[model samples]
Target: MSIRSVITTADEQVPFAAVKERIVQAMCAAGLGAVLLFGAGFSSMETLHNAAHDSRHSAGFPCH
Candidate 1:
């Protein structure tokens, strides 16, 4: 059998919408986890910018 015919013959039991929903839920969970971990001192733009600058410097790509 050809590749397309073989693939078409395989069972497709799962719906596309269900797969998309699961992916969205996973992404939301990951975003929430990141917020909980790194949202403590990110109350202001200046603080966030400074933290990013310091990180870049530490990583040897200084923006000074």
Candidate 2:
């Protein structure tokens, strides 16, 4: 198959609306993750704090 045909076929597999929806979903997921991160920081529960602390260290966030 020619390069143009290959490109066109790949492009048709995902519609613009589908791409936009995926972007929106990704943004919403990220927002929720940020909220959870903030909530974990303020949580009074020791388990939550310890889990978040360990995860931060694993992710190289430099939390003491």
Q: Write the per-residue lDDT of candidate 2 for residues 1-64, one digit (tens) a residue.
A: 7898656654467789989999999999999999988987778799787887999999989886
Give TM per candidate.
Answer: 0.43, 0.49
Highest lDDT against the true fold, candidate: 2
Model 1 over residues 1-64: C-alpha lDDT tens digits? 7887557444666589998999999999999999967785556878778888999999999597
Off by over 4 Å in 2: 1-13, 46-64
For model 1 the local lDDT of residue 55 reads 92
Q: Which candidate gets the maximum TM-score versus the true structure?
A: 2
What value does the lDDT take at residue 57 in candidate 1? 91
Per-residue lDDT, model 1, residue 10, is: 45
Lowest lDDT 10-residue stretch of candidate 1: 5-14
lDDT for predicted candidate 1 compared with the true structure: 0.82
Q: Candidate 2 local accuracy as lDDT?
A: 0.86
lDDT of each: 0.82, 0.86
Report lDDT (Cα) of residue 1, candidate 1.
75
